[model samples]
Target: MLGRLNHVGVATPSIDDAVARYRDVLGATQIGEAFDLPAQGVRVCFVDTPNSQIELLEPLGPESPIAKFLEKNPLGGQHHVCFEVPDIHAAKAELEGKGVRILGEPRIGAHGTPVIFAHPRDMGGMLTEFMETPREGAH
Candidate 1:
């Protein structure tokens, strides 16, 4: 139902500082350019690792979900983990059949693929995102 672990989403107060931390501190050199997802109400950057990627998300407005997360954890932390799926709608139906609670309807994700989030409560306290595999060259 799921492919490789796509990325680990980390909420941050500043994407710039987060990128710097990954570069100067972790010696990461494959950080993707930060971009704003106004529709999602956040700015996002990707720090590519050998195995997977680290996604840095900074809320664009106080009403963003990330901002609400920051209210509980001022320092910000792991927001969610995303996995690639061949078909998002199929995967959603499969998960629903198994009684997993999806947070909302599928929508365009950061990677320009359809995605849906499974509720944390139903996912053993971990918010899980399933994103459809991108087309060739989409990355």
Candidate 2:
């Protein structure tokens, strides 16, 4: 159902500082910036590395899922593990068929990708997001 670990989402209150720290100081390459979902209220920037990317997430509004997470945790850190999937809808169906609790339906994600999330309770207390990269010619 899931392919490779696509990226790791890290919640941070200050995305600017995080980008600088990871790119300038740590020497990671800057890939690009993106907004995951308006409903989710998250703006993310990617820091490229040899193997993967560092996804820096900042809440766009107080009601954002990340904001609520920050309110309780206070300390910003790794939030979720994103897995690359061949087909998001199929993956969601497979997971749901296996009794995994899905948070929402597959929707257009950052960079026009298709994605969905699974509840933490269904993933051994860890929030998991599944993403399907758009085909080269399709939006």
C-alpha lDDT (0 to 100) for residue 118 of candidate 1 = 96
lDDT of each: 0.94, 0.81
Superposed on all Cα atoms, the candidates' RMSDs to the truth, in angstroms, are 0.8, 2.0
Tens-digit per-residue lDDT, 18-83, candidate 2: 877887779876567655567569988777677766778888889898998889777678899888
Which candidate achieves the best lDDT against the true structure?
1
Model 1 spans > 4 angstroms off: none
Error of model 1, residue 85, in angstroms: 0.7
- How many clashes (backbone atoms < 3 Å, residues ≥3 apart in a chain or on different chains) does model 1 have? 0
lDDT of 1 by residue, 62-122 (tens): 9899999999988889999999999999999999999999988999999999999999999
Q: What's each prediction's TM-score? A: 0.97, 0.89
Least well predicted 10-residue stretch by lDDT in candidate 1: 1-10
TM-score for candidate 2: 0.89
